[model samples]
Target chain A: MDLSALGSCVSQVSCVVTQTTSGLISGMLLFLVSCGLTLIFGVLGVVNFAHGSLYMLGAFFAYTVYVPTHSFALAILAGAVGTGLFGIVFERFFISRVYGSDVLMQLLVCYAFVLILDDVVKMVWGASYLSMGMPEAFMVPPLFIAGGVVPPFYLFLIGISALFGLALWLLMARTRFGKVVRAAAQNGDMVAALGIRTPYVFAAVFALGSVMAGAAGALAAPVRSLTAGMGFSVLIESFIVTVIGGMGSIVGALVASILLGLIQSFGAIGFPLFTDGLMFTFMAVVLIVKPTGLFGQRVR
Target chain B: MQAKGTIRHGVSRRAALKGAGALTLASGIGGFPHIAKAAGKVIRVGMNTILSGRVALVGTSSSNAARLVIDKFNAEGGAGGRTIELVVRDSKGRPDEAARVVRDLMDVEGCEIILDSEASSGAFAVHEVMRTRGVLCIHTNSETSQLTADPKMHIPTVFRSARQGIQDAVGGGQYAAAIAKKKKLTRWMTCSPDYVYGRDNTAQFMEYAKIFDPAIRLVEGAWPKLFQPDYTPVITKILQEKPQALYSALWGGDLSAFIDQGNLYGLFHNIDTFAVNLGDYSVLKAVKSLPKGLHSGSRYNRIVPHSAANEAFYTAYTKRFPGQWPTNWSWQNATGAAFMCDALKKTGGKTDGKLLAAAIAGRTIKSPFGVKGTITMRAEDHTIIDYAVAYGITEPVDPYLTDIQMADWGAILEHEAEWKKKKGYA
Candidate 1:
């Protein structure tokens, strides 16, 4: 090949690599958010409509914590723990009442939570976009990969998400507690008959899911703008991930999130206006082909 | 075929008419006294704005500014001995609610004049209501070019006090073009919200920049979804393209988010950033520590106009609302209220919609932030003209701009008529 041809090939290769890296980072962020949604639905059988709000609250709490302490790590910790506690309270008071009720009742209760949480955020923060300033370490320099300079923050996000994913896997797949949670997800009545406290398991799952959402929010605070309706924006995307990944499967959420991130990153380059429509269309196609989703179990 | 007993029980049409007439007479007498009491006591000005949502700051600040102006007018025994009573209704940033509140303001509250401080979408809906009701409306804070420029949408009774997007775009574009020429930087890109306001503003800026410097070429454009929290993909795309300069129209939280994220990627160090709406105090305060040398145009910086009127208003406003920096909308609403008061004074307190519209048309009124020339309400379009268009580099403090460059209104308005004609809006 001529030098010009070689240059063109090299450029194309670099473009692909950069896009893949971008997709991976985006996917990891989505997984952080969707893992909680799927977990709550898996064990508790309650789709938390306010999952996005919890994510938003996480970011806001991080901002509140970071403002005084100036420590991003502490902010993330406080945000996750604070949101987890809030989830426990919500589950105990509101969600508990609607347990085992009609699906419509469950949806209405969660949707109401979405509205209340959104308003509560507005009341506390006042409706303006806020930023969590980037830490000095993240701003030092960019790392070059495939001729594209990638921000270190992206790598940081990817690393943390991977670590969390592994931790969750170990807790779910290897531990005795994990076995109980998995068994409960399959049959809560059977687990209760086996002398387990099912309500505690449900609350624990809800709180854990909320903590993941809060952590995602705190992590995203530096990368994204913190605004009142940010939860709705992420919520719609999380719902898509949950549906496509089989609603309650963490592993399914992981794969679906990566697929979505790839689609979005490349689709944005190919067709900017149709990026969102493309995702929805993919979801529709998936639902039509496999009614139970890629990783969902069949209902009895 | 009706039963005889039921038919007898039903009142005859004649008796019903007599009873209705008696009730009407009683209502007229009761309402007459209230009408007389309201006649010359107060001039009710109704405001429909987003006061309870994500963009509530815009509405609340605008309303407060209008109230500030109204309070001053009322304190001085009002305009022609009639105190101005401001009634604000929250629109929630929804168009339907904006229309509904506007109707309630006119029909139920009997407001002679209306001030709409909604965003562009809601403003258009409220404008339709104002046209249908024939109520004079002074739009306090919408910046869509089409709202006033589109002849099909324009109503004689409606006028905008805020700066139009196109005007700001043109000024910023020219400023960017000059910098690009001096620095030998031509490759340009845009990252704006994916909506009418964002797309139109970006297009306008690019068009003007190309016009000013024919050597200038657009590398690419990125239209992120409106209020998009994450801007990583867009930032990455810009990096890959390596544009020498970028024009962004993202405002409020979206802009703040982009700036923080872009800072992480060292995007600002590699490129010149010219944002049209970055000079607002609220946006600056929200971000706290913005990268220096980011260029922005046409935000109300108290020092840009440097007039006594502006200084006095700033001093009074800051004192009244401590620690709350006045936003661009605050000044725009204050300007609108001032213009309305001038028109009212000219009309000798006559609140007739058509007459008030006529009184304001082709009239020149001094704004608190005006630079000697004052703003004119163009008779042809009923839009404010000759508002200050200034661009400057961002600084690390409150009111964030330094070394300001002011644009001549004549130059900016030169192509506006032709541009509107090309868009089929004139």
Candidate 2:
């Protein structure tokens, strides 16, 4: 090939690499947000609309912690723990009362939480948007991979998300709490008959789901502007991801998030305006093909 | 009225009280006629702006500026001894919500005047409500040209107290085109939000850029969702295309996020990024690594007007809100409040919508941000004119902007009128 043709080939390769990395970066954040959303559905059999609000709270907590400590790692931990603790309290007071109740009641309760938390956030953080910015560790130079300019922070995001997914998998698969949680999800009455203290397990599961969302929010805080409506978009996107992945499937959430992320990244390049609609279309197609989702089980 | 300001010319405390007492006798508090009630009456002005969404900083600045102006006016015994009271409400950046809030403000809250600081998204809705309600309204932050420029959309009671997109487009195009000429940059790209304000601003800016620099070719236009959490895809696409220059109309949190994300990809290193909204001190200062030499239109930097009045306004604003510099919305709302106060003074503190609007039309108010110490409410369009329209290169340090280039108002007017005619708005 001639010099110009070679240059064109290189440019195409560059475009692919950059777009792929962008997709992964977005996908990882999506996975973190939706994994919890799906888990609530999976274990509790309740659609927690409050998930996104909790995620927003996590970001605020992270900001509150990060501002004083000036440590991103510590902030991430604080976000997770802060949200996890709140989740426990919420489950104890609100979610607990709605167990075995109508789905509408559960939904109403969670929606109420969303409104209350929204106001609480506004009262605390004020109405203005905020940015965490990158900590010093994540402020390194961009890494060039095959003519693609990738921020090292992007790589860190991908790495951290993977680690989180692995740790979550281990917690669910290898630990005794994971076993009890899975068992409780399968047959809460049977476990109660066996005297496993299922209420405690339920609270643990809810808090665990919240922790995942908090970590995602904390991770996203650096990359995205924090605002009162920040979680609204994420919640919508995560719902789509959860639906496509199967509402109860962790592995499905991961796969769907990555796929949707890639689609969004490339769709932005090809059809910038329709990128928002493309994912919805994808979800529609998925629903048509598999109403139960890719890995979703039948209704409880 | 020619320069010092509309009503700021040597009006002392005693003189204001005297004028107030005289107006009370002459007007009898616009037919209230009860001395006790008239002495305690206040003109209520309502504000509906984004206070909880992506652009909440705009509302914060706007409300703060309104308070600054209103408090000063109230302290001076208001317009002829009547105090002006500001009632601020958050629109939350939704159009439907803005309309609802505005209706509530007018009907339930009994606000005689409205100072709207919504972006174009919500401002359009506010416009419809104002048209229906016939409330005297000053759009303080809605920069969309059609808000005032279009005759069909005109309400005699409504006036724009902020810069219009066409003016910025003309001024910015002229500013950016000069550098493009010097650097011989022919290829350009745009990444404005996918909305009316964004599309119109970007297209107008590019049209004028191509006009000034004939060699310019717009390679592509990337339209991002407003308040989108990420701009990586947009950045990557721009990087792939490798345009010599890029322009975006994203503002507030979106702009801050875009800049932060772009910095990651080294997007601005080689590209001459000209973002119209980047000059807001909060947004500019918030960028993690604000790339130096980024071109932007003046958005309430105290240095741009380079006048004592402008400096004084900035100093006072900063003093009022410690450690917080005013955004573009601050001065626009300040000017809007000033316009209202001056008009009220002219009308002997009458709250009639048409009467107040008539007083506003074809009048100039003294502004720290004015080109020649005053900005005019044009009689034709009811939009502010002669406000300093400028562009500058950004820095990474304090003041955050340098190499200021002022846009010629004559050229701006000539092109704007042409643009208006082309759009059939004239």
The reply for model 2, stretches above 4 Å from the true place, is: A1-11, B1-41, B94-110, B128-135, B352-355
Q: Write model 1 residue lDDT over B361-400, tens digit each, in one string.
A: 8898877666564888888888888877889999887567
Docking class of 1: medium
Model 2, chain B only, scores a TM-score of 0.88
What is the TM-score, restricted to chain A, for candidate 2?
A: 0.94
Q: How far is candidate 2 from the true structure (C-alpha RMSD, Å)?
A: 10.1
lDDT of 2 by residue, A123-174 (tens): 8887677788888887776888987778999999899998888888899889
lDDT of 2: 0.86
Q: What is the lDDT of residue B390 in candidate 2?
A: 87
Interface RMSD measured for model 1 = 2.1
What C-alpha lDDT values do all the predictions have? 0.82, 0.86
Write down the TM-score of every candidate: 0.92, 0.90
List the per-model TM-score of the A chain: 0.93, 0.94
